[model samples]
Target: MSPRLVRIGLGLWFCAIVLFLLFPLVFLIPLSFNESEILSFPPTTWSLRWYRVLFLDTSWSNALWLSVKIGVLVTILSLFIGTASALAIVRHRLPGAGLLYGLSIAPLIVPSIVIALGMFMLFARLQWLESLTTLVFAHTVVAVPYVIVVVSAALRNLDETIERAARVLGADPWRTFLLVTLPALRPAILAGAMFAFFASFDDLVITLFVSGAMETLPLRIWNDLNLRLDPTVAAASCVMVAMSMIGLGIAEFARSAGLRRLRMENTDG
Candidate 1:
């Protein structure tokens, strides 16, 4: 095909894909407004009863708190382990780095069901079910590789000479890293942590395996969806999606700001 026609075709394809992906989200918003006793379309009245009911339910509030706590803990653990591993691989040039990196990334490629089964077995054997600590640890294992990949990319893009220069100026290794390296890695770290939070918050398989009595949002949603879905679920989904979108927006903004600063500094130099 001609280049011009190819461009037009690609544009049309992109638009079609975007619409297809967004259609369900668009449909759900209005559906959440339905006031019917059953979750049927074309409701006789539009009301806020579902939303009111959602807020009035203590179970949901507790679940939200639980999920938030897990997400934060998972993000922190992921950042610590992932950043350390990334720094070692990228900066220290550790032996078997490729193997280490691959192992770290294994969770992403492996079937989640398999991962869940393994976790469930481990928890059952250890009698650690319903422990948020185990849930955090398991999620951290899955979430860390993303942080590693992102932070390693940032480290790779950054020039090593800056840290070397700091060392030459008599700054200790710790000081050099703290002053020069960490600042440059901040944006990628922030992005990765945000992503980790979302991944853990939204995870169902692993959480379901480890969570016996503890109910995260996704588990709760899954159970409710399997039984009877109310417009409250839809409303809750809308709120969660909105929060995710906002977090994504902030991450993108931070990334752009970091890149812009880098470019300006390079231009000045």
Candidate 2:
């Protein structure tokens, strides 16, 4: 086949894969709007009753709040820990830096179920299970690697001479980072925080293993599935999907802004 034809075929394949992936979400949107008690696709009637349940129902609302709180805490902790790790690996060239990087991202490679099981045992011994703090900590472990990867990539792309200039100007390491490095890292930091938040918010296996009594949004959805089929679950899923899309949009905007600033600086230089 000609190269142009091959390219056309690849483009069509990519579009087909994207549509296949999005099919479930497309199916769920209509189900979420269905007024009927049953979760039937192509609903006979449409209403916002399920959406009302998402807001008015105490269980769903409380679960949503808990998930948000955990997500925020996880994001903050992950950014702090991950950024420092990334800096150490990228800037300091610490001995065993490769090993550290491997360890940092190991959670992503290892099966999540294994991590959950291990965490369950550890938290049980620490008597930390069923606590919000425990959930946040567990989520932070999973989230930190994303932050590290993002910040490390951004750091690699940064102009190192600016940092050197700051140091030569008699600025302390801390001040140099605050004035030079941190500003350049803002977009990556924001992106990492969003990813971390979503990771925590969407996690179910870890939450199920560690949480004995605490209910997160995913846990609440699972409970609803077991107890009874409710259209409210669809509404909740839609809300989460919307939240994720909004977070991604904001992250993309921040990334573009950062790129524009970088371009302007390069031009000025």
Candidate 3:
């Protein structure tokens, strides 16, 4: 086949894949506007009533607030732990770094359900179930891997000479890292924060096992699905999707800007 024909075929394949992935999301938007409370596509009598219900209803609003709180906590914990692990592995090159890296990311390799079950058993035995701090720690276990991956990749690409230059200029290790290394890593850290937050926010299976009486947004959605089909659920889903897209856009913008700044710095050097 000619190169041009191959390019055309690839383009068509990409478009098809995009459509397939977005098919459900495309239908969900209209369903969220259905005035009747029923979740039906090609919504009849379109209205914003469901969105209002999502915000005004105590159950939905409370669940959403809980999820946000947990997501923020998970993001903070993951960033600290994951960044430290990445730095130790990539920069310090500690003994058994490969083994340490594998262990750190082992949660990503393991099935979440298996992890959830183990956590449930352990927490139950310790009588720690339903505790907010325990829930945050559990989410952090899964979310930290994303941070490790992003920060590790960024650290690998970062110029070590820059750090060395900072040190040679009489900067202490802490100052060099805080002033130079951390600034360079802002984009990766932000992207990792986004991933960590969403991982905690969207988790349903693990949360189901440990949350006990606490209803997160995902738990609320699950209950709604089981009890009734309503446009409120669709509206909630749309809101979650919108928030995720916004977070992703911000992360991408930060990454691009950081890259541009690095390029300019390199040129000046």
Candidate 4:
């Protein structure tokens, strides 16, 4: 085939993939505006009644609040643990660095259900089930891998000479890291925290297994679906999508600003 033909084929393929992935979300967006009690296509009326329900309904509001709180905690815990693990693997010539790295990333490859089951059993034994702290810890297990992957890549690509220069200038190891290394990795750290936040916020499988009577947003949605098919669920989903987009936008802006500053510093040096 000609080069032009190949380019055309690739563009068409990309468009097809995008459409396939977004088709369901596109279908759902229309239903959210549905003023009717039932979820129907080509909504008979467009109103914010369902959106109002999401805010006024105590169950939904509480679920949303709990999910946000847990997500924030998970983000903080994951970033702290993951950044330390990544730094250890990349900076130190530890005897079992490769093994430790593999262990850190194992959750990503291991089936979520398997992890969920194990956590359920462990939490049950420890009598930690149905607790927010336990949920946050469980989420951190999955979220940490994302943080490690992002931070590890940033660390690997970092120019070690800058950190060495700080050390040579009478800076201690901690000072060198805080002044040189941490600033250089800030973009990746911010991105990783965002990933961690979303991972916990959107999680369902593990939450279902371990949440028990506790209701996160996903659990509330599941319960709603089981009880009845309400247009309110559609409104809730749209709100979740909006929140996710806003978060991603903020994180992208921060990451880009950090990158620009790093580039400017490198150029000046």
Query: Which pairs clash inside model 2?
Result: none
Which stretches of candidate 3 lie above 4 Å from their native place? 1-7, 259-269
Model 1 lDDT per residue over 1-269, tens place: 99999999999999999999998787777767778767776566898877776667887767778888999999999998999999999888899998998898888899888998998998899998888898898888788888988888888878899999999999999999899999988998898888888878888999988888888877877888998888888777776788788887877777777777777767855
Candidate with the larger TM-score of 3 and 4? 3
Tens digits of lDDT, candidate 2, 21-103? 89989878999999899988789898999999998899999999999999999999999999999999999999999998999
1-269, model 3: which lDDT tens digit per residue? Answer: 99999999999999999999999888889898888766666877988998999999999999999999999999999999999989999999799999988999999899999999999999999999998998998999999999998899889889999999999999999999999999999999998899899999999989999999999999999999999878889999999999999988887787777778768867965
Candidate 4 structure lDDT: 0.90
Global lDDT scores for all candidate models: 0.85, 0.92, 0.92, 0.90
lDDT-based ranking, best first?
A: 2, 3, 4, 1
Model 3 worst lDDT run, 10 consecutive residues:
35-44
For model 2 the TM-score comes to 0.93
- Cα deviation in Å at residue 159, candidate 4? 1.4
Q: What is the alpha-carbon lDDT of model 2 when measured against the actual structure?
A: 0.92
Please write out the lDDT profile of model 4 over residues 1-269, one tens digit for every residue: 99999999999999999999888788789999989999889888899998898888999999999999999999999999999999999999788998989999999999999999999999999999988899999999999999998899888878788899999999999999898899889988998898899889999999999998889988898899999989888888888888888888877886787767767766965
lDDT of 3: 0.92
TM-score of each model, in listed order:
0.92, 0.93, 0.94, 0.92
Candidate with maximal TM-score: 3
